[model samples]
Target chain A: MNEFLEQFLVEARELVEQATADLLALEREPDDRASLDGSFRAFHTLKGGAGIVDFAAMAHAMHAAEDVLSTVRKGDRPVTPDMIGECLTCLDQVVQWLDAIEDSGELPGEADAEADLLAARFAARAAASEGAKANSPVLGTAPSSATALAVLQEQIALLAVRGEGLEGRIASAGRLAANIFRHLGRFDDAERIAGSVSESLAGLDTTSIARSIESALERLADKLSPSQIAPVAVRPDPLSRTLRINAERVEALVSLTGELTVANNAIGHIAMLAQEGDNPLAAGIADEHRKLDRLIAGLQRAVLELRVLPMRGVFQRFSRLVREMSESLTKPVRLTIEGEDTHADKAIIEMLSDPLLHVVRNAMDHGVETCAERASAGKPAIATIHLRARREGEHVVVEVEDDGRGIDPNRIRKTVVERNLAAADAVAGMSDEALVDLIFMPGLSTATDVTDLSGRGVGMDAVRASVERLGGRVQLETRLGSGSTVRFLLPFSVMMTEVMTVEAGGQLFGIPLDAVVETVRIPREEIRSVGHAHAFVLRNRTIPLLGLGQTLGWAKVESDSDATVVVASTGGLLGGLEVDKLGSRMDVMLKPLEGILSGIPEIAGTTVLGDGGVLLVLDVKELLR
Target chain B: MALTILVVDDSKLARMAVAKVLGGLCPDWTRVEAANADEALAAMHEKTPDLAVLDFNMPGRDGLDVAAQIRGLRPSMPMAVISANHQKEIVDRAHALGAVFLSKPLTEPALRDFLAGAVRQIEAGAA
Candidate 1:
């Protein structure tokens, strides 16, 4: 099951308990920095881990507790009974969710309520203790006004505290303002403000005179980008346990692995050439080739292993969403994620996120029954949604399943006919399974009414189309009373793309392996022209064809007696691209279009060939769109 | 009825400007002006406002004297001390008395930020 979650729960339990004890100790001895730091680290760790596992409510509660302890650490607010109580409550809430996660691979249903209650309490305590002296704002990170704002605020509070050098500082502050205005060519206003400051120095009390100086200084600092204001370092370390690495670094590793594989192939080619020479070095070359080949293979595997991430990251994000959806709909729901340790390529895991989220959304919004309905149907009052992932040979299957009232096949049949999605006779001949599967059809939602969660009718079909675009397949399964499961079958890794090379418009282009249905050489005369586009019959259906040179904005040249067409499909749409010829299919590590070229969607990504030239991969989905 | 904010500064011009600002931006807020600690304390007892803003250095009994006395009277009253002397210990003392602080000649943005924060505290106290 979720072994990773099991480890997280065990460590989290200890951290939560440790934090609870530290908070109690801090209550007894408010100035105990050791205990304060202990609690801060514990909650911070707990919050980070909880976020990783998708225990949102727990993460949220820990976050608030962390904030409270931060104030204590900063010496801004002394440990109060209310703060201690709030911290303990926050700890208790996280522990409760941890227990639920341990027992079931899901958080408890009341998590949101607990988070809200604890957040409100923390906010109330923070509000009550208003000396909210945060780190003198990070001037370097903030706008120019931030430093001025901090200085202005500090000086305002300092007015009454001034004993010595009060007049000199005020005079200097006035002169600073006058100097600024003088440089800006507002000499009259400058003189007026400066004269007022010098005169007010004796006319008003110390507080009022200081106020006048503060106003003049504020006007000076307003336009001046003088980075003179100093900010105090008010942190106990926001990062301690974790080391964050850049994404570019990880991608560079992947790119190097690609080059390593290419170099390894060159060694094999040399070994073959040596064998033909019939020399003593031939045997050595062959032996070295075998050893190098194995080493390169292992190196490539290790590199790919770095990019493989378990499902926990994506699955953890869903629990909070389910909690939010349940709270929003006033429907109690539980989310269970299994096989969280089942690792997939990081890119593949991220690409699978949107489709899986939509499926989970649909499961909670429409698949689950209300408490009253569930009670009447002799089921648990709290609806359950199970998110399962497992490796099935070549593909990893992720399923979002919910046991509630399932889709009615008869309703689908009716909607199919009503929406003109299918002919009346065609729908009449469909079986229950086939009819239920029609929910995957675009613009054919079975929900009686639209709600915030679902029933937009664009939900399931979009999931299907995206999954298909990622070279994966989405399937729907249901029984009338047994609920439904939306399953997405994805590849093990998306780091390396298997693309079929095609020569188009005298330049080379790469078509993703999944997008290519077949490359057929059709007779030139058989290509019929229809509305400025060529077409040809495939089976009984007419498929539209376009010249690759024309599509790429190159001048169209007259074709030969025969044409080589690349059959491409994106979701349900089918099309043909007539190219000069097809080349050898190769595996490539694609770096998606970045920088200025990133927004241009037609070119999906680029990859390096053995000779180091870049090959552009075509995104058929955007191409058709 | 409009909420009230007491503003105590020794200078008449300073107090009048604050009153004008209260009337302009926060029209509903009634400004209870005071020239010193005694007047501020007297104004507070007569009709306590939702918030208190006092100048730190006043004649006779200073602003901190007024805050200390007010804390003794209404321990949890939302109070602020405006000063130009940014001595760490002095600001710390004001903070120790459970009073927030502001710089002199409060600008519009700073005033707005402080009010938003203080209002939350007031609402939380009420809750």
Candidate 2:
């Protein structure tokens, strides 16, 4: 699931609750915009959320409910008790759909009935309104729809205006005929439009035009029966239509071939190295070694790239979600999606969606606000959520930022202490930003009760765990009452590893580059002691330093004032690690720990370097804890 | 005329990749690489290429800065931005600065399309 969907789950659940409440309230007083807006938001958000999870059935159902509410919102049709009942029932069905989705990752079969009924109600109301308004459109608020329809009607008229023979007329009339054909349930006409639209939009924004076509198809679905609605081949797996074979895979395969060539050369070199002859094998060994080195280097490059996938795959789903949430919450939000082409590995991308969702939801539910509240604060009622991705050095950083209520670090401190999750003294000394991070701790929630949207203690921890398992870090930044942003620093891919070879205890241990911050030579004079614990002054701050020998229960070396230190940090905690020597960075594939060795909390994974030597990758986060 | 192109990116590797792709496609065209927009601007002041390919996100004065400056300095100079950040604001700004916008991880297809478009625009302007 993407960030929008996860956030939508929380928002949808909340929307369902709100929708139910709004429905009950509307039963008594139907004109309240708050209730109507709330109900609309719930359905709209539910539709968007369902779309993200690929729960098309639920999305379709919610779309129907949204259409009805949207029409009512425009006052094109009055919000009758029957409409309210049906809308509320739709909400219940959506809730049930969400439940089913959660249970099975799919909406129930035969679920489209409710959506069809609701859509029929909307279409019937629209027809009745059309009958009543012979002079003007009854839905008088939005001119956009009217303008578009006028365009359609004009095109239909022009087809009659221009009879035949002129090639221009044939093309223009063809388009109009196709538009009328698609909307008027003429399969042949719709196909013509599809063909022309595909051709015309060839050099234009293909995605947007396709999306518009998709919307047109959706709107047409209400008028036609199920069989007629799916006119033309529905283009089986339309997703695959746009999907290109991931270039990273091709790049990786190329690099692997390069590596295999090097490995073969290395085998020849090893054979020559074994038969150490003064004049016989030395030249052959040198030549083979050079080839082996070249091939290995090429292989490493390919493997690293295999982890790099375009960021677009992870960023695409949020747009529909933001659209839904903005409408439902009655907070106009435009998603500013950036870095769609920023690639990261598939595993990291998959792991990323959950955390991003939680953060975005947190921003929407608790961070952003009602229109009235926003107006009072002199902020736009329609908030802006920036979903951005970038490659910062070796890490893929994803940020979900909203222009709503910034998180109150003070509130976090209070929540932490009140919940008894941490000591008051610890939180008191901690910066407000650090206090905010307490949200990621297990069983830590500031919300009093589990609302549909927030106060569910599952979000931050799940995000943190998922990101960490993918060899990444998550950070939360918020301004007091302004808005908040949660960023995940993820590896390019989960499969490839970047390890820094370090000498510790006379053995070469490969520490994952993700864990190592910087290798610095700690001078003897700068090292001090805070009682029995060793400390070092870095940038005028006393940071606790640990020797790998002592931290990992290995025997300590004899006194040496100057120590080679690996400065490392994870999820925020920073410390210096003493090691013998810093080695070169190498790409290695991680092999999982087995048996009792797996129980070692400080070891992340083990990998084999090009030299066919096994090196243990340390888990810096575990050591910091 | 074979178009002379300049590629600007903060990352040497990324710059090399674009150069490699361009070199493979239009080997006759002269391609120069710059690390930052400022350097690119300075390089252009010396000898402006037929077109400049810029990276949008950079440490100092980004692609937008280079684009706006280039547009101001030489109105007819064709420029294209290969951006990791495909924000609408950036795209709008690029268009406003008379620069063509291309999203990053610049594959052969995207680059080919962009180059073709740039060549046409430049040729049209010249005409």
Candidate 3:
């Protein structure tokens, strides 16, 4: 691929994004002049770009859409939803073309047929609008033809200026006349004028060329009716101060930084070993280790910052999705986005799209009420779904809130019992919040009938699982009659995690330190059997206990002494794990389990320890569940 | 002597396209590029070029607007106003400003003819 094509791909994608944003904005506010003109210019410039690359099919398609927008700009037609839809459809095709070009390093071979269909759609919409204005004087020809004739007359007048560059000026006038004729679809006249201009240019005779253009204008004036010419509006181009870098390169840098931090930790381990031996250089080695640790910490932070991206890109996509969903379901729902500028790690943002899509879809499908239902319930006819994001402490919290019928705790309780997920007596004794949380249980769905958008029994649990895999948590709050909001609390970055290593089944495993409340030594006799489970009293509160060796299916060693226990909290529930021993704490970069091991929910990921051993990190939430 | 030609377009791709063609046609001539009218005018003020190729549709001020200003400074400089949009208003304005109107995507044949005419005019004026 040439440099021009590469640049074109990048720029064309940006233009498509900008144009889609503008069209969506126009859909909300039809009379917004800035958005209308912005959409027009984006399309105009996009068409020009296609022309530059000799992509005639794309240029032709864009020209059709641009003409419709030009009519709206001229006040001949109002900005209708149908018009916006057609233009958006055109942009979608452009996006597909851009992707194809990027993949193949050239224009797609099959674009012509797609472009034709898109152009036909725009042309049909334009013709329908033109039919409505049948009474107008300019019937067959567009108003631009009149402007072309006026320009032809202007070119003739310009011939009167006999000056230093007269020869070039005359050649330019001839080319302009021929082009205008061609633009009006008068091919024969365009050719004749072009031929005559070439002849006149060879002789340097201004009078003959002027006569030829005047005669052509006279003939054209009879066919083109006069129309008002609108002045072209000017808008300032936005300047970009940021540079575009390849995403893979950034990922590679992040991986290298992770390895460097691990190497630095190894140095710290060596320094500790030196101190243990009482070596003469122990103090100096420890001091140097501390300095390396601080510098690596800064480098880690700077590298992580490169991957931070604003949530706007992810949030903006929901607008179009919600719009299409609203139309398809025949429901009037408006998606209001807030705090889109909140930043998150790029990996988190990329993984967020699917989960967010499911959440928003569920909110609209099951949470928001229909217009009729809302009207009878004394609520507004149009329901609103708020997609919000914000930074809260060490986490970025993304929330999807709806203003409609909230999730009924009774329905969830019934579904839990029907699905046999929990005992009926236990569910009955649970609070409304606890009952609602049961919606995250797999195979439990309150909706009686499944819809295409959601309610296939694989939603909230998957959402929770995905969030947990990213070292995050999901929370749901519902107000029975009002609405529901699902909040995802995600870490600001996912690379580095502080973990406390524990000896379980004679092997070392790392448990995320954030979940560890405290470590204790408790007599084995204090653990009371609670029907297939075990519980122990800690500070007057009964906490469930699990033997790590037994849970991991390892050979248990018979011991009568006090058991070493690590108390941890996951999903707001406290639990104690009996391990063989508890080790020191260290920050390690986690790599998610891939291939066959990925199916195990209890193990979140693995990290390389300083001694080059793999430390398996436990997912406390998944384990407790 | 090699001459300097000013190329102005808001779209970097369009500017590059023209530069690519011009590079092939006139390798000895120096090409100066500007992204918008401000930069184009600034370049003109810094050093008047022997020729200019301007895009008709740009942000802030279109190409013809810049051409008119350039005409005020150097009336006899050969210029071509290029645009994908072939509206009569732009063509007439280009003609009124004594500029050759070239439609885009600018073809080699069309640009080559304009450059040939420009070189002849420049050499004639020098003589």
Listed in order, the DockQ scores are 0.01, 0.01, 0.47
lDDT of 3 by residue, A314-337 (tens): 776676577667656667676777
For candidate 2, lDDT tens digit of each residue in A1-625?
3333444455566667767888778778977887777677566545544654556767766777777877888888787876776676566556545545443444456455344444444444455456732222233322223323444433333334433444454354344435443423345536746575555445432333334344454454332221111101111110111222445577657556545643553465465555675657667767767676676666655665654555554565565455445444445555677776677876676567767777777777777766677889998645767888888876788888877777677877888888788888988899776677788888877664565765577788888888888887777777766887888887765666777888888787777786677778878778888898888987787777988867788798866668899988776788988887887776666768888789998888886545566678888888888
For model 1 chain A, where is the 10-residue window of minimal lDDT? A230-239
lDDT of 3: 0.81
Off by over 4 Å in 1: A1-252, A261-297, A317-324, A327-334, A348-354, A371-382, A408-444, A461-471, A525-532, A537-543, A595-600, B1-127
Number of the candidate with higher DockQ, 1 or 3: 3
Q: What's the lDDT for residue A573 in model 3?
A: 70
What ranking of all candidate models by DockQ puts the best one first?
3, 2, 1
lDDT of model 3 at position A94: 83
- The TM-score of predicted model 1 comes to 0.47
Task: List pairs with backbone clashes in candidate 3.
Answer: none
Worst 10 residues of 3 chain A by lDDT: A227-236
Top-scoring candidate (TM-score): 3
Candidate 3's TM-score reads 0.69
